[model samples]
Every structure is written in C-alpha cells, then in structure tokens.
Target: MNLKARITRTGAILLGKYVACDGFDEQQPIRVVTHVHADHMLGLRESLKKCEMVLMSEATRDLIDVLKSPLFLMAGNVKTLPYKEPFEYKNEKITFYPADHILGSTQVLVEDQEGERILYTSDFRLPNTPIIRSDILVIEATYGSPRCIRNFEQKAESVLVDLVDRGLCEGPVYLFGYHGKIQEVMEILWKNNIRVPFIVPEKVFHVCKVYEKHNKKLGRYWLARSEYAKELRSKKEPFVAFYHMAARRRFIKEKAYKIFVSGWQFQEPIRQVNEKGFVIAISDHSDFEGLIEYVRKSKPKLVLTDNYRIGHAKILAKEIEKRLGIRAIAVPPTKPKKK
Candidate 1:
C-alpha cells in the first residue's frame, strides 16, 4: 500500500488521488477539514469551484456556513459527515477523529480498502486544551520548538486579566481570537469571575454553539447587535467580545479595549494587534516536543510537512528516522499563490 500526501499552506493536502486535506486546489477533488482556522480554510473557495465533494463535521459545516462571505461563498456544497464515520472516496475509506484543537476540529484518518491507514494531524493540540480533549493524535508543531514546551494557560489567562485590571482602558474588552480558542477563553473568564457582557460576531456565535453542543460552556453574554438590544442595554458591566481578527478593526472604533489571542501572536498579524491592542500567546498547536512525541507514536513509513515550518519538518523527519528507524519524508513544494 502506497500513501502519498501533498501539504499546502491552506491546510489542504492532496491525499492519494481524490481526497484533499483542506483548501480548494484545482488539482484535487474531495477536501477534508481538520480545523476551520483561516490558514486551513483559505483556499476553500477555489476548491469548491473545481471539486465535487467537501467533507467536514456537522458542526464545522455549520460554522463555515455562518461565516458566509466572498471567501466561503463557494462552500455551500460542503457535506457534513459525523466524526468517525468512514466514507469512501477514490476507493479509499477515510474517517475523522476529534483532535481538540478547537470547535469541530478533527484529525483525519485515511485508509485504503486493503486496510492501510494514514493519519493527518492538521493543527492539533494533544491532551486537549481547556475546552476539548485530544483523542486521535495527529498534531501540529507551529510552536514545536523546545522553547515553547511549558504550560502557559494559567499565565496566559492572568495576562489578559492583568491587562484589564491595569486600567488599559475602562471600556468593553474586545478580545480577538479564532473560533477555536474563544469558547475556552470565555469559560476561563467565567471561572475567574470576569464580569462583563461579552459580545461575539454572528459567525463566531455559530461557532461557539458547536462548543456548547459538545457540552463546553462559553460565557454569559451574546452579540452586540440591535436585535439583542435588550441584552446590550441591560449590560451591568464591561464584557469581552471574542471575534475573528477581521472584526478587530470595527471594535476599535467602538472605543472598546482590544486584545489579540493565538499561539502565533508573536508573528506579524498578532504582533501588530498587540502593539495596538492587548495581546496574548495562547496557542492551540502543540509545541515542538508534543509534535515529535505524537508523530513518533503513529510510526508512518513516511511523513509530510504541512507547510508552516518546512525547515523544522525536514529536520524532525530525519530525527524520527534516525531515532526509530522509520523513514520520514518531507512533502516538497512551497505554498501556492492565491489565483
């Protein structure tokens, strides 16, 4: 059984013949999503234009639908498949397992009819995060360097609180994070007694519902739209508005205190937001050690680097082979430009 994977920055991988990891590559057919972060879903529009089928969890489909815009307009045809339901494509049976990276996030398992299985861990966190539990272990090591191997959840939360308490601004706390970490942060705020009427954009509101569907609690608030005027007017205290990065610009005009969240906060976008808004490096991707450990367990005959840290992937692939005698190969080619 021969397994091949082509990793793309949009988190789309050409797996075997007909299946794709994420994104809308004109070259592939079916696309499977492990998570809905922008990088993963960036190329989806083009994918739907060329492919016939797109597979994702029911909750993820709903969230994608909620995020209707020019980017996701072509996603109308996405078919919702329940987690663990093995489906046939290109004569291969593929299954999705929960990865606990964020809401509706999953780790993909592709198996041939002859029972050869290949697992793709697209931006995953092992042992789970605050809101979700890690099950099948295909993990992402965006932070998979030795320097990021410590538990920073408590410290991260305190940083947010400290910013608010330090009188950065006496206004609505606008925290910018993706759908993956929003609910977890909200739960943390609730647990820490951060009393505020949290506001979330409609898109993220739908995304948060999925977390609630899995029994994870978001905070005690709603959207800031006029429809929720009663709730908005009755707000007794300031609240956190968990939103997508795009929504940050508008919130800034509302005179609300702003915050940016992510594991990649040290990078350009998040860092830019930090200079203008309160920022924290609460990451969902596994650190370097986590990535090495998880990949070692799978024992694949070859490994593919999923486009973020190519140098790291190449180095780690060699280390895996040397340490375990299992051959690991990095998927070649850089990111495809948007057409």
Candidate 2:
C-alpha cells in the first residue's frame, strides 16, 4: 500500500486521500475536523462548498453551534463520529480517540488494507487514556521544548485558590484564559469548595453550558452581562471574573487583579506589566517530557513533529532520535500558495 500525506506546520491540518486532519482543501473531499479551535477549522466553510462531508466529534459540532459559526449553518455538511470507535472511510479503517486537549478534541488512527497504521494527534495533552497504536506517528509539538516542561497540575488549583483568596481582599480577581482552560479552572474551584460566583464572558458561558449538557457539570457560573455581574459589581465587594485573554482590556477600568494563564508564560516575557496582568503557567499541550513519554508509549517507527514555533519540531525530533533511537524528523511548513 502506498500512503502519501502532508501535514501543515502547526499540525492544524493533514492531507491524504482517505483522511484529512483538522483542516480542509478542495483537493480532499473528506475532511476530519479534530476540534473547534479557530486554527483547526481553517478552510472548513470553503471546503463545505466542494467536499462531500466534514467529519468531527459530536461535542465539537455542538461547540461550533455555540460559537455561531457559519459552518453550523451549512446543512448536511458536518457529520458526527463517535470517539474510540473504528469505522470504514474510503476503504480504510479509521478511529477517533479523546485527545484530552479540550472537551471534544480527538486523535485520529488510520489503518490501511495492508494493516499499515498511521496516527495523527492534532493537539493533545497528558492524563489521556491510550487508544490504538500506530507505525507512523504525526504529533503536535506546541510545548515541545525541554524548557517547556513543568509540573503545574498538582499545584494549579492551589495557585489559583491562593490568588483568589488574595484578590478577594483587594478587588475583583480577573482570570484570563481560553475556553477549555477557563472551564477546567472553574471546575477546580468548584471541586475545592471555593463556591465563589464566577463572572464569565458570553462565549465562555456558552462553552460552560455545552460542558454541562454533556454531563460534565461545571457547577454555577454567571454570564458576563447578566444581573449577577451587575449585582456583584454594585456590592463593591471582591469577586472573581473569567474572561478570554483577548478581552483583557475590558476589565482594566474595574481595577481587577489580573492573572494570565498559559504555558508560554515562562518562555515569553510579559509585556506592559503595569497594564497587562501577571502570568500563571498553565497549558493544555504536552510538555517536552510528556511528549517524550508519549513517543515511548506509542513506540512508533517514525516520529513527525509539527508546531507553530520555528525550530521546535526540529529540536524535538533530534531529542527523540537521540534518546529513543526512533527515526524522527520535523515537518516543514507547506509552501505559500500563488496569488
């Protein structure tokens, strides 16, 4: 069996005859959307014009709906697939497994007629249950450097609790994070009995509702503009608010105690310290150690790394070859299209 594939730099997209991962193009009729992240959904709306169907997990489909994406408006364009279940697509056996990146993120496993296997992990993190193994492993290297390794989960809740405690005495605690992270933090707070009413942006609230609908039960959270927020603000008492990082500026006037959560907090310098917020190291992707451990567990014959950071994939590939003795290489970005 001859299998040829091309993956983009960030591993946001993969191209092949039977399986197209996370991204879409006119050439590939069957596109697999791994999750609802903006980068992963590239060309989806345009691809629907020509493609037969777009494959994604049900949770992701619901997320697109909550996001009010145009893709949701396209009738019969999206098809939902169950996770960890194998199905035939274009004569190849394909399976989807929980990626543990976000609520509905998944890793694709493909088996050809000859039993040759290929796995594409679009964006993943640790603490995930193992699914199928593969011969050729194409993995994301978002936090792929030795310097990116950090054991934050054990202390993440404590750190946030401490910050919340301190901020309660000062002012409203503003936490800046993405959709999944925000939900996870809220769950953590709830589990710890923090019980503080959380004010969340509209999008974040939508995601929380989806989580609850899926039986995850993120507890209670008020939408940003709801009466709950007005009541909390009018009390002149300290409160907690969760906002997307892009909306950080909206809370500046409130004089809230701000904290930005991300894995790159250590690597990238915080800009405009007086205005921007403090950094809290947190990540959804596997670190250097976790990536190495994943490679060891998968025990793939070939390892391919793709990430947004230049040289990250190459560096990780080198480390894999040195330590694991696997044939590893970094996938270069695809050439730019002509005008």
Candidate 3:
C-alpha cells in the first residue's frame, strides 16, 4: 500500500500501481474529477487522450453536458461514480462522498487491499459527510488563515435579503457571484417568498436546470440573452439579475445596480464600494477555525496540505502539529529539473 503524491497544474496525483487522481488530468491511468471547477479541470481534455478512464460524479457529467464546452472529453471517456458507494478498481476500493462544494463535488476515499486508507478532500466546506478513518489525509487550505475566519452562513441570508430589498428600490440589481454562491442566494430569496424575475447568465441558467433535475427548485429565473436585455431596457420597472463575476459589466449599460459577493471582501483596504458596486463577504470554503476543527476530528496519522494557498498550508500544518500533535506537512509542488 505504498503511496506517493505528485502535484500538477491541475491538482494532486497519488500513485502506486492503481493510481488515484484527485482532479482532472490524464497524467495517471485512473483519473477522478472531484468537481467541475475550472481550476480542477485544467488538463481534462488532454488527460482523456492519455488516461484509460476518468471517474466523476453523475452530477458533474450532467454539468459538462449543459456547458457543451469543447474543452471536455467525450462522454464515453467518463465513468460515473455514485456517492458513498465503494467500487473496486484494480486491487483497491474507492468511495465517493458528498464534498458540499457544489452540485456533484465529492471527497474521494481510497482503500488498498492491505487495509491502508487514504482520504483526498479535493475541496470541501462545513457539514462534511465523509466520516471515515484514514491513515493519510490530504486536505484543502483555501481559507486557512486566521483573518479569513468568519461565520458567513448564519449572516448571509439576512445581509442578502436586505441588499435585495434595497436594490429593488433603485433599478435592475446585478448580483455578481460564482455558481454555488449564486444558487444559494437564489434559494434564500425563494424560501423567503421574494418572488421576482431573476435574470441569470446562460451558464447559471443551465446549472439551475441541473439543480431542478435534482429536485432543488430555485424558483423563477430567466436566461440573460439579447432579447431579454432589450426587453429589460424598454421596461421602466426594477428587476434583479444574478450574473457570473466575469459578465457583470455587460449589464452596466442598462443602469443595473451591481454588487460583488465574495469572502475576500473581508480583507484588503476595506473597499465597501467601487465604481461598479458594493462588495459583500460571502464564502464557500471552510475558514481557518473550521480547517483546524476538521484536522482535529479526522485524527489522521499524517496530514498533507493542498497546494492552494501554500503559505496558509505551511502555517496551518504548523498549527496542526502544535495543537493536535499530528504529523502535518505542507507538501510543496515538485519543481522541474533542468536537463
């Protein structure tokens, strides 16, 4: 059950004989895509060319279908892995658990025939579902800094509701956020019975459909298109639009009030407002306290930090070692050697 970890531009690759890839890439024989985030799917297309098979959650496959991106490999190349079910691969058992990051995100658990367990948490948040014992734990440290810690979930609902209420009074309100955060905001609005036509970008519209397919209705939403934009411009009524951060500026000509939602708002020079709009503190990844708590509860014999926010990983590893007495180390990426 000897395992070695290798980091690539896409993500971490664990190798032995039956390789377990944590993210999208064809560098290994067996590739496991934890989620559909762009960073995790860097070499997805190229990997499909070299790898035997790529494993991912059914939800991820559905997401890829909706995106219709040429970057993704063919459907035949992907093998859907059901959550929490153990599947035999080569001489090892692999299980997928809900990662709580996005709609089909998973935390992979690989167990070798020799009873050695390895857990690779690609990206996760609070209220994780995986509760298994592991010999080695590879965890993400996206927000592994003391300054990043904040109880956002408990406060996000109220803050967003207030913002929406105020924005509706002005003109078309543009809410800028990522896929998962936008969905959460929509759900909050729905549960509060704030019935309003929400204009979403094309990608978000497709993602919402997948959520509905899973029976998670996000209320009334229309895709933002040329026709819809013209119609909105003609109308004199105020509306709400949820858009991806990249496309937020597109609606500026329509006099839409913009608001950027992200956890990074907490840091920096306290920029409450910009030329475009205001910034709000909302995040998906676990904060510093949550990261420490996870390590304490996992109780793994050895801990390996994710390459994301490597500086935070180094600091977090030291804290884990000092606080929990666990053998923690920030795994540095292998540097290329000069020929």
Candidate 4:
C-alpha cells in the first residue's frame, strides 16, 4: 500500500513501480504520455519498446500519428483514453484531466488500492485548468520561480493581434513557435478577425488540419508551396506565414516581420526585439503564480517540484514550503528530506 510519486534522474515521473509519466523508467510497466512536446517525451522509444502499455489522450495519439516517423500510432501497445474515465489496473486506478497546455495535454491522477492518490501536473496553464486533489502532488517547474509570474498574461492575445495587424500592413508577417503553440496563435488571429491569408510549411499545415479535426477552428490557410499561397504572394498582399521554431530561418525574401512566440519572457508579454522582430510571451504552461495556485487549491500534503526541466525547480520547492506550509521538495536530489 506504499504508493510514491517522484521524478527519477533521467526525468521520468514514476508513480511507484506501476506507471511512468512523460519520461521512461524500466521498473514502471505503464507509460503515460502527458503531451506531444519533445521534452516531455524523453525515452519514449524505450518506453514503447519495453513497457507493457503506453497511454495518452486521443488528441495526443492523433498528433503522434502526424508528427512521428515511420507511423508511430500503428503499434498495438499504444492506447488512447478519454478524459475523466478511470482505467483500473491490477490494484490501482488512473484518470486523465485536461491540462490546457496543448491539444491533447492532460494531468494524470493515480489512486492506489488503499485510496492514496498522486496527481501529476505535467504541463498546464492555470486558466480553466481543473485542480485535481491528491495526497502527493508532482508538478512541473517550467515557470516555477517566484519572480517568473507574468502580469500581462491576459493581454497576450491582444498584443499578438496588434503586432500582426501592424506587421501585415507593411508586408508578410512570420509567426514562429512549436506545433501546438503556433496553432494557438493562428486560432487567436481567427478569433480576432485578422483577415489575411495564412501560409505555413508542410508539417505545420498538417498539424493545423489535425487541430481542425479536433474541432479547433483556425482561419483560412494554405501550404507554403501550394498554388494558392503562390497566388497570394504574387498579389503582393499581406500574408502571415507560420513556421515551427526549429525550421524558422531566412526563407522569405521580402521585408517581412518575424515574431517568436514563447513563454520564457517575464518582463513583458510583448517584447520588441528590434525594428521588425518581436517576442510574444504567450506561453502554454502555467506561470509561478498559477503553479502556486494549483498547489494551494489541491492542498496536497507532500509536493514535489520537477527539477529535470529548464525552469526553477529548487526555488519553487522552497517557495511552496515557505508560502503554503506544505512539505515540499525538488525531485532527483542528492540529500534526503528532513522529516
């Protein structure tokens, strides 16, 4: 009846010996993928190879069908479970909740036979995110620093639209981010009534089609090399081009504006890098305040902040203990917790 939740040195989230989340651990038989982001999919191949079964949301599964090489979804071990449906194993039950981070992102809650619960908030934004209660809470520390709070989060959409509007007035505007994030910006433009044609790379076009299949509406867009896009380019009209950050470069020749969309900036939501360059702090993950707020709402007795990711894990653990009076620790540490 001893159920534990902690991150391993290899960035694996192990719930006892039963489940591994995001990362992979051999001892864990079931692998639960929270999302499709590369960082969260560490040791995914190993997990798929050795683990008994791999679990993810249906959208996450569909996304893998598009993004991965050699057709990843064709495997029999991969399973897609709907949200709020508890799947019972030998002596435990697991459930998925919407993470609000990406298309198929989720927060996992595992309950032992004795009713002890452990919730993993892998990557999520606080807005409209459900707070799942648990005895042991394992959370991401991507924006966990006390000073990492974004005051202008509510204004990110407006700022982005304004930037695009101004950029489009002059020439074609380029928007860059990861898969889900760039699609989010596209939805924002559509919602704000930014009526200009969208041109995206091949993979990006496919990802947007997936979003549409999931009932997420995006404005009219075309593939970069398609005849429609070429026609729009010939017109010399303003168009927005979307590219994943990894593939972004000097592809467009005209005086086009470039905007990098990410959540790393803390100073302002919209940061002007140069005359034609801008950085939008429109993040998918929760900020420091949102992380703390999740902790406060869930009221977990023991909290573990993930130290494996890029942000301030130790600082978040310290802040959690100091501010919420909860027993908090950063995972994969050298020293044992002082009880």
* Steric collisions counted per model: 6, 0, 1, 0
Off by over 4 Å in 3: 1-10, 22-27, 226-229, 251-254, 267-271, 308-311, 333-339
Which digits, one per residue and each the tens of the lDDT, describe model 4 over residues 240-260? 999999876664444678999
Candidate 1 C-alpha error for residue 237, in Å: 4.3
Worst 10 residues of 2 by lDDT: 267-276
Q: Mind giving the per-residue lDDT tens digits that candidate 1 earns over 194-305?
A: 7766777677777677677767776666765745634554653455667787676676565556777767543322233444465677777776666777766665656665
Which residue ranges in model 1 land beyond 4 Å of their true spot? 1-3, 8-11, 25-28, 69-77, 129-141, 158-171, 227-237, 249-257, 265-277, 308-312, 318-325, 333-339
Error of 3 at 65 (Å): 1.8
Error of 1 at 20 (Å): 1.1
For candidate 2, write residues 95-205 as lDDT tens digits: 888888888898888887767678887777776746447788888777677777675556766777776677778767888888888888778777777667888878888
What's the CA RMSD of model 1 in angstroms? Answer: 5.1
Quote the lDDT for 282 in model 1: 75
lDDT of 1: 0.64
- lDDT agreement of model 4 with the native: 0.88
Clashing pairs in 3: 26-47
TM-scores, each model vs. reference = 0.77, 0.90, 0.88, 0.95
Residue-level lDDT tens digits of model 3 in 1-339: 124444544454563345556544444578777877776665666557767888899988888777766355574377899988888978888888887777888888888777777887777778664545678888877776676677555776677777777778776788888877788778878888777788887889988998888777688887778576658747846667888887766766756567777766444422347554777776667778878888888778888876543337777777788888998877654322322
TM-score of predicted model 2? 0.90
Best by lDDT: 4
| Every model: Cα RMSD to truth | 5.1, 3.2, 3.4, 3.4
Error of 4 at 264 (Å): 1.3
Candidate 1 residue pairs that clash: 12-22, 13-21, 24-43, 24-47, 144-287, 144-288
